[model samples]
Target chain A: MNPKIAAYLRDHAPATPCLVLDVDRVEQNYRRLMAAMPLARVYYAVKANPAAPILDRLTALGSSFDAASWEEIEACLAAGARPADISFGNTVKKVSAIKAAHAAGVTMYAFDSEPELKKLAQHAPGARVYCRILVENKGAEWPLSRKFGCEMGMAKALMVKAAEWGLDPYGISFHVGSQQTQTGAYQAAIARVAMLFTDLRQAGVNLRMVNLGGGYPVRYRAEVPEIDAFGDAIMGAMAEHFGNALPEMVIEPGRFMVGDAGVVSSEVVLVSRKGEDDPVRWVYLDIGRFGGLAETEGEAIRYAFRTPHDGGAEGPVTIAGPTCDSTDTLYEKSNYRLPLALDCGDRVELIATGAYVTTYASQAFNGFKPLAEHYI
Target chain B: MNPKIAAYLRDHAPATPCLVLDVDRVEQNYRRLMAAMPLARVYYAVKANPAAPILDRLTALGSSFDAASWEEIEACLAAGARPADISFGNTVKKVSAIKAAHAAGVTMYAFDSEPELKKLAQHAPGARVYCRILVENKGAEWPLSRKFGCEMGMAKALMVKAAEWGLDPYGISFHVGSQQTQTGAYQAAIARVAMLFTDLRQAGVNLRMVNLGGGYPVRYRAEVPEIDAFGDAIMGAMAEHFGNALPEMVIEPGRFMVGDAGVVSSEVVLVSRKGEDDPVRWVYLDIGRFGGLAETEGEAIRYAFRTPHDGGAEGPVTIAGPTCDSTDTLYEKSNYRLPLALDCGDRVELIATGAYVTTYASQAFNGFKPLAEHYI
Candidate 1:
């Protein structure tokens, strides 16, 4: 655990199983991203840690927002962000939400199908619309399945349809995947976008922007490249592909901007052995899959855990959350190792968990309150 | 969809992506269980669906409750249930929750660990306690992982410890698993509990009760045997193992009692082809994994879906939920076949979803409201 975070926990004595976000770290992360990619516009994805304080801090730092629903647009507006600075980034949106977003003065939106384009034209006529092109997201830690984007043929047709339907064919957008680590994935996606841009221009549709959707990674259990490395690779790829005709570039980062800035402190509920000869012990914590850490779905994303009892001899342990549901077990297959002395009531800090924890917490499962969030 | 539920939706026109619970069906399910297992007391597991109306109806029907937390106990109380009719059934519970349950006059509780017994001694002394013995949970649809119970030796030790700590060693409890279809699994678990009962009696810890934990299956996609088959198997096993020495028998049933009594009505959000050559068409619903259908975790539990346009010849489809997350796809791997005429704005009803859908819904993800529930 970071000494600063430990001290903050000690000083405030906030409720256990609560999320603590370090505002200073968030600012530093924001500044680092801005400094690394000077030419690209930053739109912090609001679905990640949409706590008012995080949004206020980012809004004060002049960060734009990538909102998926009208509630997110309202949240951004309440945090003092201009509607022009918010883009409705979800390709699949409710028609009423589209009208609400348009009426709220939000103009930028994303779509991937002809039906969605028709909905956009019906609700948000003359809105700046971007068609997302599907890209191969093979190397991402959390590869987005074919849930969001469209093929090149469909994308070209959607852009043309948007123009005919009286909506501005603003640009193109693509998400490599969440927690994306490989820079080559971005390069490959950009290359695909460049080819599509040429094809769209030849078909008489002028694009003005390119949304490199959020997938930048954070250092959790695995080592990931720094922001500067990704910035350099993206800049080089854009230059190599589009040369001097690079459109206004924008990046939507959810995990990278706030992942390292927050830590979740949970109390150990129980420490027991399943059998006498069992090699690994089971450690149950107050927070779980439903509490906040839903990203541990299939154990694809592993968060770094710490106990104050660290530095003792390490032993293999299976960690679980405090829920009656069987699927609440967190690291039964991941081979998580914790200090031998860790027991019930010991505090375990899950570091780099700021991004996707809070908003995903179930309201009340088994009557347990959702994981509370405490801002530092 | 049940014709009654379809008519209910057509007449009421409740919001889309909402759960419609059939109260009359719930009562029928309760009566059917009562008729099947006359010797066993039924405790409706409150975690399944703790809706106030359901609880009130069940309470009026003189149904006992299996509460997992203090809030559930309170919910039962508010629904007019006596404290003596509630059992604190979760093995892992907060110390404060134990105190609260004890203070609220709940006497029967379940525990499987030494630390939990010590907490019970501290806060709920002299309370009736049961030790949940670990059992083979294979062959069930949703197997209870090693999160709940202890081995035979540990169970014996725990009962001795509970007696020593001034708590009544009341019973032994074991859950076969949720959606447990095999009646033999219940017989096996009962036989193990009978052996433990003999051992505990030899150790001078005479137990008075036995809890056959919740696992009874409900018909969704697969056909489940009638409740009478399970009752006959359980009674035969008890007669064979403990012959006329059956203690005060109690059974907790979550899914079996209420699962088939509810239908979730959701509007089709989008129907688009990823590629024209792709065989499987994508059907997106207004609700998703976070919205309440989280039991689709691994596509292990497949709920039967009905479209009003159901008879137009079936075609393969990949069903997805309306969330920005890629993991929200519900039935890509489950081989869901829907009517070819199903399109956007059409209604789809997920049957047998009354048990675990609403309470597990995340509050707000991607700005979409959690699945709403309406009791009919």
Candidate 2:
């Protein structure tokens, strides 16, 4: 357990199925990412965990934000972030959202398709807009390369059209994927973006920024390469591609920023077997997929667990949530083993669960309360 | 469109991404189910969509509730359902929830394992308990046989122990699975339960009330066997196996009760191609997997759509929600097609979305508001 979270749990004993995040650790992560990529501007992906404390801390640390919608942009603005510092990063934007962001003085926007770009051009005229290009999602545990971005051919046309449509052809962006393990994924995507920059520049678009959208991996059950590795690989690729005339580099780090900084403390609701001789015990916890562990779908993003009786005799377990819905089962195929001594009411901490857990929680699914958050 | 919902939509012009559900349709569905299987009592599964309006309407219709948690029990009670009319149906429940439900005068419970049975025995002393035995989920779109239910042998032992543990070993229960199409699945499950009842009776333990847990299917994009078919098959199997000394029949229906009674009204946020010659258009809606369409995880529940120009020429489409996350993409492999005339801001209705859509919505994921709900 994180010492701060452990201390908080021991001292205060907050309710189970709540997230206890260390805001100071978030600061440390911000500083680490900044140190690793000094040339790149940090835009904390607010959708990861947009708690007031984390947003306030990041804003105070002089970090910009990659807002997914108008509400997120407003959240950043409410946290004292300048509108110019917040990018409306989602490619698909509601016209109302575009108008809201524009009315709020938010300038930067992302789009892949003509319709979305048109919405941006009409509503947020003269807004700095970036085209998100499609890139492969090879090594991401939770891939995001499918739905948002447009093809390179389409991106090429969109950039040139942006200027004609009364929007700033500010830059290009591509998310390699989320929880990306291989540094090569970034290298390849950067290469692709560099090609788009060259094509757009030749067409007189002159894109000036490169948004290396969030894909930085954080350690979970398995070891991931250090943040320095991603930073090194990305910078090297940018250097090779841009050759000192690098555009303004912006990094959206959602999971990397907050994932490892928080822990989900859950109580074991039940632990029993299918049959008397069944080898694997079904371990039910207070938290599950709908309770903000949505990333556990397909057993991707496997999370490390901490039981009260860790380091004791272990047995195979299929972990599930405390819901009548069977889909709430978390880890069934994954070879999760827990202490055999673990029983009902025993608290367990799901480690590195800051990002993507809170907001994704169902609003009282099965009438269980949404996951609670306590940022220290 | 359901005429009532269509009329409501025409009159109210409610915001996009709202669920317009007709409570009269719910009453009609309940009446239809009761007419089909008058021998069985209807226990509306509260987890499906526990909106107060639906619960209130069901309560007024004299429908019993199958609550998944303490909060759901409270919801049922607040909707005027008597405590005795509510069954704590979740197999894995917290002790606190058990105590709460028991204190609220809820006597009926469901359990799958010894640990859960013990929790019920200790917390809800003398509570009428049923053991959920696992059965095959061959044709279920949303299968529940895996995460819940125990082996038949274990359920047998647990029920015998429930008596010793100071609980009413009232019955045997099993879910064929959610959205169960083949009535034969229920027949098979009934036969299995009947054998268990005979064995228990021979062992001097008479078990009454076989709870045929929820799995009744409702129309989505495809046709399903009518509720009458399932009712007839189940009753036939019960008579054949139980030899007219029938156990009290109980059925829980989540989706069938309200799935077809609701429709989700969304707007096209964007409609564009990935590339110049890309054969498929990516239709981005204001709602996606995170916005209550979570059952679209594997393209399982394919919802029929109604666009303004639904009868117009259609093209293949990959549908997604308006989130930065790629996983929010709802239909990719499902070969879903939409009207070619669809454009940004056009209203579209996702049909038969009443059951599992509302509560499954994320709490402002990507800062998009939760799917709005209106019960008329």
Candidate 3:
């Protein structure tokens, strides 16, 4: 544990687990991503961590937003972001949400099917629209291409249908599956989205923009793809596919924008054994799978643990949240070494959890109090 | 779908994927369990749902509660359950929580370690306590036999230590595990706990209460163990082990009492296909993994889905929740028959989800709001 970080926690923070936002870290991440993708309009995926302070900082730094819901869209609007600069990127949306977006004067929303277009026409007629295209890869861990996007062949038909219904179809949108580690997958998606745009233009569908929805991988663990190279490769592929004469570029970067900017701190309740065959120690903390770490899929984002008084490395110990459910183990087995003699009431901090932590991940189980957020 | 259930939803219910509690069903479940277990005192585990109406019904039925936190204790107390009838059972509790429980005049709590006992001592000195004994389980799905219990001999020592600290050391408590399928496991736990009682008595530690912590499996599907057989086997085992000489028995049953008493109604927003190669049908609903079914544990508990119109035994379909995450699938591939052609705006009911079905299961993800509870 860093002595200074530990000392700061002891002196200032409460015993409750909290989501901490560091402006310096967020600014650094934003600047670094912008430096890599200088040409593409960087839209911060507000759903990742939509805290007002973080959104305000990103807006001041000239980052646009990708909002999936009206609440998020309103959050961005309240944070001083222009509606035209934001994209209602979730392909599946409610009629009320679309109507609200239209009333709020937001122009673009991603749509997948003929039915969605009809709903959009009823709710937000003649609204600026982007057709979300489904593209699949057999080898991807999670193929978002599976069911989200519209087919390339059907894109023209959908656009025609949109026109017939008096709705203005803008362009195309595609989301490469999240936590994408393969750069080639993103390059392929860019090319596919670009091809769809060219096809639509050929079909006389006068497109204005192309949105590559957010799936930028935040390096939760060791094997995550580097953001800079992936961004550069995607841009190069887009240039090659659309001959650099393509419509305006938009990329939704959720985890990439704010995942590493936040930390969660909680006090240890007990250091007990999780099971018997393993005399392994458990550090039970105040947070669980509910508070922003809802990776119940077992593909949980890895977290770094630190204590306020760690003077030495402790043996392998599993960290658990206070929820009585046995499935609530945070660290199944210790990946990091920690100080020995760690007792109950010790405070620990989980690092780089800012993306989907706290308010976004709360369930009122075990009568657990929701975590409060703090900005630094 | 039952016509009455469907009509009730169409007129009285707000939408599909909303939680509905049948007060009659819950009361029947409570009465059946209490009647089945004549030898043991039923302590409804408030952590399961703890909805005020459910708590009130349980309290009215003369049931005590096993509260895991101060909020649960407060919930029980607010519902007219006397503090003396509730046990704050989380061994490792927050100091403030312990104080709150004490202030409510909750006299007894569970303790597993000396450090936790020390903290509880500080908060509620001279509090009545039950030393948690970890029963050895060689093979059990719930290996909480791993994280919580005191080793047989260690429990004897902890009891002695508690007595020395001016704490009233009551009988023993052992949690077999939650959602336990194997009825024999309870018998094994009972025998072990009974032997521990004998050993403790030999060591001059006599206590009047013995808590076989509740792990009564709630049948979410048809394949789960029969509750009657499970209860009969456990009671028979108890009779064989201690006969009428057994200490006052306390059992904590959470899901078993309420799992089948509730239904979540949701509206299908859109039904779309992925691509040519992808054959999965995505039936998007307003309810997601985070709303009212968060305890499904990455699709751990599969609820029966039925369209209110007509669900015939016809074919298999993939059901996706409204959350934007690719992993937000409620049922990856569900086999069910529908009598009608299901389309957008159709309501679907997910059944056997009373436990952990309401406020405890919802996070504000995907803009899907939690349904308000109204007991009928």
lDDT (Cα, tens digit) per residue for candidate 3, span A115-178? 7888888898888777887765433443453557767877778887787788887788887776
Ranking by DockQ: 2, 1, 3
Give the chain B TM-score achieved by candidate 3.
0.90
Write model 3 residue lDDT over B1-376, tens digit each, in one string.
3344456676796744577767667788887887777778988888888889889888898899999888889899999999999999887788889988888899989988777877777888888888787765433334463567677777777777777887887878888777677788788888887887788778887877878887777655546677687779878888898878867888888888887787777788887665534445567888776765665544566677777555443444577767677666777653533433677888777777778667455466644556666566
Candidate 2 residue lDDT tens string, B255-282: 9999999999999999989898998999
Comparing 1 and 2 by TM-score, which wins?
A: 2
Chain B TM-score list for all models: 0.98, 0.99, 0.90
Across all candidates, what is each one's fraction of true contacts kept?
0.66, 0.92, 0.44
The TM-score obtained by model 2 is: 0.99
Candidate 1 or 3, higher DockQ? 1
- lDDT at B62 for candidate 2? 92
**Residue ranges of candidate 1 with Cα displaced over 4 Å:** A1-4, B2-4
Please write out the lDDT profile of model 1 over residues A1-376, one tens digit for every residue. 5566778988987888898888778888889988888889999998987889989999999999999788899999999999999999988887888888989899999988887888999999999999887888877888898988888888988888899999999999999999998889999999999988999999999898989998999999989999998999999999999999989899999999889888999998888776656778888899999988999988989999988888899899888888889899888888789998997778889999999888788888888888878777
Which candidate number has the best TM-score?
2
Misplaced by over 4 Å in model 3 are A1-11, A134-147, A150-160, A163-165, A198-208, A219-226, A274-279, A296-299, B1-10, B15-17, B133-145, B223-226, B276-279, B311-313, B333-340
True contacts kept of 3: 0.44
Q: Supply DockQ values for each candidate.
A: 0.72, 0.86, 0.46
